[model samples]
Structure formats: structure tokens, C-alpha cells
Target: MHIHENRPGVLTALNQIFAEQGVNIAAQYLQTSARMGYVVIDIEADGDVAEKALLAMKAIPGTIRARLLY
Candidate 1:
């Protein structure tokens, strides 16, 4: 998943959401520019819950997009 934002606390918010969905974040990479922020999260979740988790992530404020990597 890739998250794009321009505000503070987006990462924290994302973590909380993942936790609520029982998704374990195995790895994360973040990049920021003067006008935007990008984050890639590698998660561990069962197939039954993965789609739900991704949709939840996309619903977050400031998240530009979310999708499965594999």
C-alpha cells in the first residue's frame, strides 16, 4: 500500500487503523517532499481480512490511495 498525505499524524493514524484490523505491519518505507508525504507498508494479514484492511486504509483522511501489493 502507498499512502500520500501532507499533514502530520497520518502515519500514527494508519498504524492505529491497521491495529484495529488485526494487520501486522512487517515493514514500512516513508518519503516526504515539501508538499507531500508517501508511505509504503508491508503488512501481514489473512486473505479474509486483507481487503477489509485495505479499504479501511483508503478511507483514512489524507490517504491518496491504497491497494494490495501482491
Candidate 2:
């Protein structure tokens, strides 16, 4: 996901949604440029939960993009 600058609680909100959906985050990485924040998360979930989590992440206010790579 790519987030807008100075957006507090974005990561927390994403994590909350994942937890609410019962998705387990196995690993994560975060990077930021002058104007954008990037996050890559590896998660584990049964059936459609991963897709659900991606949908939830996409719904976040500052998310620029959220998609499954594999």
C-alpha cells in the first residue's frame, strides 16, 4: 500500500482491520519517500480472508494501492 504523508494511525488501522478479519501478519516492511509512504505486508488467512483484508486495506483513507502480488 502507498499512503499519504503525515497520516497517523494508517498502519494501526490496517492492522486492526486484519485482526478483525482474523488475518495473521507474518511479516511486514515500511518505507517512505518525501510524499508517499509504502507498506508491504505478508499475511496468512484461510480461503477468502486475504482478499477481504486487501479490500479492507484499500478502503483506508490514505491507501493509494492495495493488491496481492501472488
Q: Whose TM-score is greatest here?
A: 1
What are the lDDT scores of the predictions, listed in order? 0.80, 0.77
* Steric clash count of candidate 1: 0
Instruction: Write one digit per residue (lDDT tens) for candidate 1, span 1-70.
Output: 6557778878888888789887788999988887778788888887778788777778888888878878
Model 1 global lDDT (CA atoms, 0 to 1): 0.80
What's model 2's lDDT at 47?
47
Candidate 2 on 1-70: residue-level lDDT in tens?
4354547788898789888877788988898776678787888776488777778878888778778766
**Candidate 2 — number of clashing residue pairs?**
0
Candidate 2 residue pairs in backbone clash? none
Q: TM-scores of all models?
A: 0.84, 0.83
Q: Show where candidate 1 strays beyond 4 Å.
A: none
Specify the highest-lDDT model's number: 1
